[model samples]
Target: MLKLKYYLSLIVWNLFVNTLGKSMFTPQSIRFLLYKMAGMRTASANIRSGCSFRGKNLVIEQGVFLNHNVFIDSWEKVLIQENTAIAFDVLICTSSHKIGGPFKRVGDSDRKPIVIGQGCWIGARATILPGVTIGDGCIIAAGSVVNKDCKAHTLYAGVPAKEIRPLENREVNANIK
Candidate 1:
């Protein structure tokens, strides 16, 4: 029965989500429903088309807005809290192998969960690596590659995502979603 359920989910995703539902013309509500059938655990999110999650371990809370072409590797848990604005072309990955033998280069890091706190704004084209916990009200700059935990109410930028500054006026990001 469990196996059957998995197969059914695949059918739903492949037929609905992986089809015209991927079109930018397709409404987010319909796409969200289809993704639910495929086992994603989003309660109330506005997810645009072209967002890809290979695994079903994604948890998107209310008021979360995922922009276009967002790619998530949800092999582990990905908890995106309420009012988080994930901008276009963001890549949230949860998988990376630990450093292994010389023959395999895939084993260089550990696969871990990614947690994005509430009222956060992930800028366009940012690549969030595995095990990153972005704190509440944080803003990641565009084209930044986040490889570590981001402090609350902070602004992060650059290749490895250094903390640029503390966001003293938290009200600024409240309207991001």
Candidate 2:
């Protein structure tokens, strides 16, 4: 019975995603619609229109919102943890070219998982390169290019995303209050 269920699920998923290319609407619109309708979550989360997600290995947790025009390429597993917000036009990629030879074939490429830890905010236009992890509560500034792992509770900016400063709780509260 379980095997039958699994096979049925696989067939449904393939038909819905592959044969259809999920083409009932635009990719972003479809993602928003599906996430709102049937995507499970511990708390309500809003995914704005115009966010594009490809590949099937993606996971979005509770209270994780994907803002407008954000592009998430999930060829490998891309996990966005609870309370994380990916801002408008933020691009998260999980695939990279093979560097071994001059001409790189698609089959020779490398793919790795991208993990966005809980409570992290990836700002608008931030480009997170393949295989990078943004730790919990970290802030990725707008227009930055991140190709390295970011520490928890810190602010990272600039090309390649060097840590700028540790996040201060009192400072955050002051702004909120």
Candidate 3:
């Protein structure tokens, strides 16, 4: 079947990437080409070494930067728009488990897409859960856990990633160190 073939090819490609592709000698353009060849939607974004992915449902737009050790489990589609910068050790997953009855805490698997709008900055160690659509010009602070949608032009930082405040361009420069 087509699905079987698709999965098999993806597996092989993942294996190849996880090994030799992570080497510094491997060019990022070659990685992008390999992903595209395997039917994944990707652009000329700079994906650093040690980054891992799952499935073919991924879209990395132009000017996006993914730092080292970023993990993307794309059970469903994950679209990172242009000019977005994802810091190191960020985990973006498209698969989760539903809460079930008392006997069985974790129920069936739930897969949903994640859309990161243009010009967003995801800070280091942030964990973006399934079905999260981050709006444009947003900043996710370090070590935050994003479990819901984020609004545009805002700063979010917390355990559950509450919106700290709306971002406004200020004209004052001060150094208080």
Best by TM-score: 1
* CA lDDT for candidate 3: 0.87
Task: Compose the digit string of candidate 1's lDDT tens values, residues 85-135.
Answer: 999999999998877777876676567999999999999999999999999
Candidate 3: regions farther than 4 A off? 1-7, 169-177
- Ordered from best to worst TM-score, the candidate numbers read 1, 3, 2
User: How well does candidate 3 match the true structure in TM-score terms?
Assistant: 0.86
lDDT per residue for candidate 2 within 5-78, as digits (tens), equals 97886666545443333333546445444444433222433666555566767888878887777787889988
Reference-based lDDT, each prediction: 0.87, 0.76, 0.87
> What is the alpha-carbon lDDT for the whole of candidate 2?
0.76
Query: Tens digit of lDDT per residue, candidate 3, span 102-139?
Result: 99999999999999998899999999999999999899
TM-score of each: 0.86, 0.73, 0.86
On a 0 to 100 scale, what is the lDDT of residue 17 in model 1? 58
Clashing pairs in 1: 97-109, 98-107
